[model samples]
Target: MQASDRYRLSASATWVASVQMEPAIGAVAANLARSIELVEMAAAQGAQLVVLPELANTGYMFESREEAYALAEPVPEGRSSQAWIALAQRLGIYLVAGISERAGGRLYNSALVTGPDGYLGTYRKLHLWGDENLYFEAGDLGLQVFDTELGRIGVAICYDGWFPEVYRRLALRGADIVAVPTNWVPMPGQTRDGAVIAHALTMGGAHSNGLTVVCADRIGTERGQTFVGRSVIVNSQGWTAAGPASVDQEEVLLAPIDVKATRRARQLNDFNHLLRDRRPDIYDEQSGATAGLRQR
Candidate 1:
């Protein structure tokens, strides 16, 4: 059979899509509308799971804490989260998108997960980057894996990908796919020809932990801060399945993945299983020492 024919015959394959778009600063209504539109388009193309960029509803780069608070809302009950939930239910698909969350007077950079059944869960950003610390509280909920009909889903936003422990923790919790809602910025000393460091970091995390990673990043400039838009989807083997979209365009990339395959691949030829081979005792002691030093 031809490759296309074989693909057509695979009933177990699931299609995942990443949406890369430019969000207008403080334009919640318009941004939500555009995101819903793009998700609809992806669903029409057979995408069962869709991921949107970080701060997708509320653009990044807040000038002050007051401004950030003005844009934040309660999750699942928030307007943006409700709209995404409605869209997911209407389309019979799973959706993951970022939002500015306000809870008990504190604002967190967060991502929400919704599916055909309605609201699922939220992941607060654990690592704040640059000016983000000025406005948003660091994540308190820690890493979370949501169980859905599609598979076990995990969520991380932007800078969380920088820490391998985030991926390792999720993978250990049986996460088959990790959805990253990110607003990536150019790193210091980055060159045009060089590979996107964020993308490389994601692939390495996925490969090392035997997990599928889907990143959705935004494009264009917001409040003079430019975002790097190269939304990518990596299979469990750490290979690009969909895209590293253009640096400045609205695009959707779709790819078929088998979540179960990732579990099998973790065995890695018996000699060196991804999760089985461990020297965690030594690392844990070292980590404790480092933490103690930082406390001093």
Candidate 2:
């Protein structure tokens, strides 16, 4: 069979990533209602999957862990997460949304993937920002790729995308498409200097993994911090299939992805996978102390 013929393709399915705009700070009710409205709107537009920005429910300026904890909810049962799950079930689609998670008396910055089958998976931000370490414990969960109606989908939150290891890990785990929901703050000169870096990260990850990478970053300012609103979708061969948008307004970017093509492209081109074919036997050699290690 042809390489493309060997893979599954669902032409009827469409994926939408909502660059959820932030409302006024501490406006929990407003944010909740806005998300629900977007869910309905996305469904009406024929989206089989939808992604939301980080910290969708609560604002990002919480001064203390206590405040964030007070808003966190369990993965399958928190009030906010329950609403998202119910929406996914009601809409009969897959939804990945970042939420402030509270579990076992601790707060976490987490993302949940819900489908018609209730909660599909959850990802806690493995990489935390500056003061984030003070409020929430860093997540020990590794990269994740969940089987969905659309395809094998990988999930990662904001800071997780900054490191190449995060993307490589997800790709190694067999991800066909990676969805990242972020509130990526753009530093003053980073945009000019960082465009190349950002492009390198996106293209390198996509080409190497043979997976389409879709990133949905928040627009507008939140908690007096500016965000880099360039939500984009890159194809397997390191091509920008979709765009790099502006940070000024609320926008919904759409792209029809061919998952089979991504796989085929990798095979036809024999794309960069040298990193995947490393000699672990020699790489794992433990050096520091032979006698002490053997004695212990």
Candidate 3:
């Protein structure tokens, strides 16, 4: 190996992985075991950061609020979270996974972040989608970004991708990579032959924010609900670095990202910068113009 090539690789590369798996409804134990196996596999392939789909421990569909509450667990202290933290520490990798969180009498859709040291923090889903509103409260923790040896990491869950403000806020806070743990379902007008809208949304968010977006999605049908499995890793240029994995398969997508380089790429040209050129003041002032439309 050439010394120059080794030096370049060490300075510029960070490997990441996205795990797409199918979780049986209410099967917490089995799901956590599978997740650990997949993370180990990703680490074997040299992934420094590993991401898993939303609610990866407890499957997405719940028959009733009672069932959801029964499945929800405390963050970091939950058995599933502790297992993941131990795995991350043992493998010297970073892990971000979604879990149903129970706090007092309320349940929240949350994502847990852990690294080689231990639990970092959690990001509750800020936006609830469809039936999720029936079971979980909307997030109150706000947007969270964690600083680590790898880089600045941000987290978002499922439907949060539909809101542009989510990515903008993270970018404004200097996030280099955003790990999205999603459970994408077929939206209205979705067809088997068409491009998945979720994928398009993630790509747009990544390019606009100059953030590398890593999405880990679930597959398979649970109860009567079907999840669209198109887990993907998009580079800062809005290009697919790894997947959009099989629509109904369990797979791991691996990619190498240079977060520092992507952060620098935010400057589109000598005369333009993506975030700096934002006219936030004008938007805030004219926000009234859209108030009527919003009311409708």
TM-score of every model versus the real structure: 0.94, 0.84, 0.93
Residue 227, model 3: Cα distance from true site in angstroms:
1.1
Which digits, one per residue and each the tens of the lDDT, describe model 2 over residues 1-296? 32133223444434555555664456766877788787677666666677777888776767777777776677768777889999989999888887888779777788888999898878889999877888888886778889976888898877777787777778778788888877777654685225834556777888776778777767666667777677777777778866676656666665566666665565643654534554455443454335456678
Candidate 3 local lDDT, 1-296, one digit each (tens): 34345336776788899999999889999999999999998888778999999999999998899999999999989899999999999999999999999998999999999999999999999999988999999999999899999899999999999999999999999899999999999999997547899889999999999999999999999989888898999999889999889889899998889977898899999999999999765575455546557779
List the global CA lDDT of all models. Answer: 0.91, 0.73, 0.92
Task: Write candidate 1's Cα lDDT for 105-219 as tens digits.
Answer: 8999999999999998899999999999999999999899999887899999999999999999999998999999999999987765468999889999999999889999999
lDDT of 3 at 126: 94
Candidates 1 and 3, the one with greater lDDT: 3
lDDT of 1: 0.91
Name the regions of candidate 2 deviating beyond 4 angstroms.
1-14, 191-199, 268-296
Candidate 3: segments with Cα more than 4 A from true spot:
1-11, 285-296
Candidate 1 vs candidate 2: the TM-score winner is 1
- The alpha-carbon lDDT assigned to residue 288 of candidate 1 equals 50
Model 1, residue 11: distance off in Å is 1.3
- What does candidate 1 score on TM? 0.94
